[model samples]
Target chain A: MKIVVCMKPVPSSEARINIASDGRSIDPTDVEMVANPYDEYAVEEALRIKEARGEGEVIVLTVAAEAARSEIRKCLAMGVDRGVIVQDPALLGGDGIGTARVLAAVIRELEPELVLCGKLSIDVESDVVGIALAEYLDWPHVSLATKIEWPDGKMAKVQREIEGGAEIVEVSLPAVVTAEKGLNEPRYASLKGIMAAKRKPIEAVTPSVDAGQVGAAGAGVEIVAMNPPPARGGGKKFEGEIEEVVPQVVELLKSEAKIL
Target chain B: MAGRVLVFAEQRDGQCRKSVFEALGLAAQLGDEVHALLVGDAVASQAAELGAHGAQTVHTVEDERLARYWNEGYAAALAAAIDTVQPDLVLLIATVMGKDLLARVAARRNLAALTDCITLTENEGTFEAVKSMYGGKIFATIRAKRTPAIASLRPSAYPVPERQEAQPTVQALAVDLPAEQRARVVEVRKKEEGQIDVQEAEVIVSGGRGIKDPKNFEMIAGLAQVFGAAVGASRAAVDAGWIDHSHQVGQTGKTVSPKLYVAVGISGAIQHLAGMRTSQCILAINKDPDAPIFSIADYGIVGDLFKVVPALVAEVKKVQA
Candidate 1:
């Protein structure tokens, strides 16, 4: 079995995101970037599959800029066998199609039987690339999988998290699945794994697909403007007995919110 | 002339979900032709209902292959729907399933697709949608450059149309799905009996770490019971294993916009606030006056939840009686 883990770097959760003066993009300098937290789960799942199977190559794949090489190397440190980066500068901010177009090409080259990704990039929160890639490959795909079992070479049994319920889906091999949290606890890089990763090769490859078919020309959606969320007015607070505040709340609900 | 708007009718177990009607309302608001595409084994029963909610035409693709959600099957049919309609705008309800299928369809067509939009408005033949980014810290309004611009509305963020007894013309659309499917849902496990879906609930009563014990959630449950509301939990409570993940409402959990959200004992973090801030009314109950939740709440009470929650439940019951 072979596996490819797709990941993107996002600003560390603690880093404050500042909109650049250009008003169209984040000021990349102000924030420290890390592998997306969700992607850690994907990387870990790939490593675990290798451990369980006892023999396979796990490759870290990404469609990002030159800066992302270090991020991919971190996954390599976590015990992946190899790293592949699709380093076309133009692919930056490629809409889902643009991303799928690039990723699908590299995936075809790697020819991994399974591809895993974080459920969504924490930065853009688009949640599209993995499914779009699956579409391009015409493979079975599911998002938010809590549990998965590969019963045979051709199919994997998966329980996907849907609102109000869980859906158990059976997907054929060469399928795509995005990792939601709770899928697994990602392993920290061991001293041995880290040193081994330094010597391991990081391969740089560009998507051979036609750019016009993918990210070019905005891929359909345009970011017309960027702005911060409107500040909400400070609300009323009552410091007293629940008895005192209850009636006031009911009154306000009836008058202001109009739900009562 | 604004071009035709199209919505994909989302259904499960033969019942049309609320988001479809909301999508239809958006379609009606945006364009002259408000058409919807419905696919399933026997979904025609719900066509009249879609018609009542502003869909001028119901495009039905009834087939057994689509009875259960197979991503490829749904995507193929939806891509065909787009081709036939050649709509200027395409809308889908922002549900877990809707998000999964819409992106694939958009990708197959190489169309731009946006998800989790909270609000939208049209001007000069272009529609701009606003949604929070970075765990709700920032808001961005965006548009798609391509015709048949695709997007999904956050659940309950948009209004569903009022029921008017009107019949929409139902037309049959033929779509052929490939024989060998890549993925197919084989089983569905519903949440245990009588528990409401938090995002779909009109009323939500949530608890936080302050509940102190797993058993203490009963007080919060009592309040929810009083109002026939769903029970929700903060990330702290869930991370501590006091409640199930299904009950969690936050950035890492589920986003909900109930009509009335009663948040008890949660010291609101940005993650927790992002999920429920879109709710119509928020009532925050916490002992600390300085708790962050109070800032966004419509009403707040600074007191021990043990003393307050029972009393408030009784008060609500009294008013109802």
Candidate 2:
């Protein structure tokens, strides 16, 4: 079995976001970038699957700036066999679909039996690329997968989280599955794994798609502006006797908030 | 003006979900003529409800392959509907299934789609959508650059329009399923009966590390029952095994925007705040006055949650009486 894990480096959750002077994107300076938390689950699941099979390969595929190679190395350090990063200046403004197009092109060459990615990136929060890549590959996709089992090496039994519970799905091989929280606790890179990762092969290539289909020029949507969230007003805090303040808070909920 | 807008009405158990009406409401507001697309087994029966919720036309594609959500099947059905309707804009509610289906449909057609939009406005024949990004630290306004622009509205972000007596024209769309299908839903296990998902709830009562023990979640659940709210928990509570991960609200969990969000004992990490800061009204109860939750809360009470939560629940009952 060959499994590909799609990963991206996103601004850490703790980093403060600032709109760029261009007013359309975030300022990259001073931002601490890390592997998207959800993708770590994807990498972990891929490694676990390979280890279980004992005769399979695990690869990490990413489409990001050249600077994100370190993030890819972080994944390799976690026991992935190798990595691939698609680097192109044109991809800087690529929307989710554009990124999916690039990824699909690379995935076609690899022809892995399964593909995995985070359900949604914490940075863009669009939740597009994984399913879109599945579409481009013309394969079945199960999103929000909390558990997955390969029964007999040709079928995937997945437990996907839904609104109020879960659904047990059976998808054939050559499918895409997005990792959700609770899938597994991702393991940290051990000293031995880290040492092995330093020598792992990572190749950077540009996507061979139409010039009109993989960049800001090919973007179907454009971010016209970026700004801070609207600040809340009339935010009042009361500290003192709980007996006195609880009633006052209830009064406000009734009259002011109108939600009572 | 965008002439025709189409909404993919999501259905479960042969019934249209609340999000279908919410998407229709926004579609009616944004498009000159609003159409709804329903794909599932025996879904035509719900077309009337779609009509009531401002759909000028309802398109139903009935097939067993779509009885449960398989992305390829749903995307093919939606693509067929789009080919037939040729609408300027397509809308779907940002539910778990809806998000999965939208991305595939948009990608298959090579169109631009904005997911989880809080608000939308018509721009010429295209659309501009506002959505929170970077875990609610920033807001981005996105503009679609082409026709048939696809977008998914966040659940509960828009009001369901008033029902009208006028009947909408019902069109039955033919499903052109692809020959190769590799996935099928074998079984769906529903959680506790009558439990409301935090994202769909109008009111939410959330707890955090301050609640102390797993047993104390009962207090949170009790307070939630009084207001008929869903139970939510911060990451700390979930990590401590005090609550299920499904109830967690944070950067890694579900992002919600309920009508009223009551944070009890939650100190509000930035990640937790990101999941809920967009809520309409926020109330926080904590012993620490400087808890970050207070910064965004519309109202706050500094005290012990055990003392304040039960009291607040009683006061709410009294007010209702």
Candidate 3:
């Protein structure tokens, strides 16, 4: 079995984000980048499937700038057999649809049996790419998968998380499943895996599609302005007596805000 | 009218979400006829409710396969619905299922789609949607140029209007689900315990790594019980195994905006803020004065949660008594 996991490089959850002067995007300078947290689940699920089968390959693929090479290397260290980096100057500022188009092209070339991705990237939180890729590839897609089982070569059963409960779905082979956290615990890189990852193949490919063809231009949605939310003002400390503070706060909500 | 507003009434187990009614309230202001599309088995029962909530017409599609959502089936049905309606604007609740299915529909139709919108207003012929990015640190007003401008409104951002006493026209639409497109739904496994779903709760009390230990959540739950609120956890708490992912609120987990949101021992991260920032009244309790959650909270208590939460719960219970 050949399993391909699509991942994106995003700022580490710990990093502080500063909006650019334009107020449209984040400032990437000095921000430590890492694989999207949800993608980690996808990678770990792929690894688990490969281990269960005892014979398969897991390839990690990403579309990022040259600065993302080190992050891609981190995925290699995590036990992926190889990496594919789709780099292009025009790829910057591309929306979800643009990114999906590029990924579809890459998937066409690789033709993997199973595709996995994070349910949504933390950076955009759009969660569009996986479903979009499935549509472009004309393949069945499942989102928010918590558990997966391959009953046979042609069929895969997956447990999908819904609003109130989880539904078990059965789809044909050659499908896409977007993984969320808690799907599996991602393993840490072993000493042996880290050393071997240094020799893993990392290939770079340029998208053959143009910006206009893939609908990269003319973002229907444009960010008009952005600003930090207002700060919470100081509040009186009600440490001495509960009786004193309770009525005080209630009176404030009723008289000052008239909400009560 | 230049643009017709379309609302996707999201339903689970035959009940429509509050966000659906909220979307209709916004659509009523657009001066366009609001048409709602309901998909599921025996969903016609909901058409009257949708009509009372400002939808001029409710399109009902009854399919047992659609009762349990599969992205492909939902997307295909929605795409077909859109083709039939050809509306100028499309709106959905920014729930997990809506966001997942809308992406596929937008991609297939080559239309622009925006998610997590807190507000929507029209300018000229264009509809501008205000969305929070980088969690809630940055707010952006976005305008979609494409026809049938697509957006998913965050829950609780817009209030649900009182139902009007009007009998709306109900249309039953037939959607052909291709044999190859049918994905079998075998079973529905609910969370073992009957814990309230954080996303559907009207009130939520969440904790983070600041709580320090898993056992400390008892105090958090105590406060939540006073208000009949659901318990939530930040990514930090979930990552530390203090709670399950179903209780997690953030970009990766569930996005919820309840009427009242109380954060205990949570130092708000940007990702965490994105999930619940749109909540109506926010209260933050923490020992650290510098916790980011205080930034957006309407009420802040700078003290240990152990003392603050229990005291607050006691006061609430006394008031109720």
Best by TM-score: 2
Report lDDT (Cα) of residue A114, candidate 3.
90
Local distance difference test values of all predictions, in order: 0.83, 0.89, 0.79
Candidate structures ordered by DockQ, highest first: 2, 1, 3
DockQ of each: 0.66, 0.80, 0.53
The runs of at least 3 residues in candidate 3 whose Cα sits more than 4 Å from the true structure, single-residue gaps closed, are A239-260, B192-194, B269-278, B288-297, B302-304
- Give a tens-digit lDDT track for model 3, residues B89-119: 7889888788887888888887777787878
- The C-alpha stretches of model 1 lying farther than 4 A from their native spots are A214-218
Per-model TM-score, in order, reads 0.94, 0.97, 0.92
lDDT of 1 by residue, A1-260 (tens): 79998988888755666788878667888688989878888899888888988888999987888899889889888998888887776666767667887898889888999999888877777768888888888777888887788888468888888878899999888889998877887789999999999988889897678766655454666566667655565478888666778788777777888865
Please list all clashing residue pairs in model 2, or write none if there are none: none
Model 3 Cα lDDT, one tens digit per residue, A44-115 = 999989888898999898888887778778878888999998877676556676688788889889989899
**lDDT per residue (tens digit) for residues A2-69 in model 2:** 99999999999878888899998899999999999899999999999988888789989999888999
Task: Write down the RMSD of candidate 3 (Cα, Å).
Answer: 2.7
Docking class of 1: medium
Ranking by lDDT: 2, 1, 3
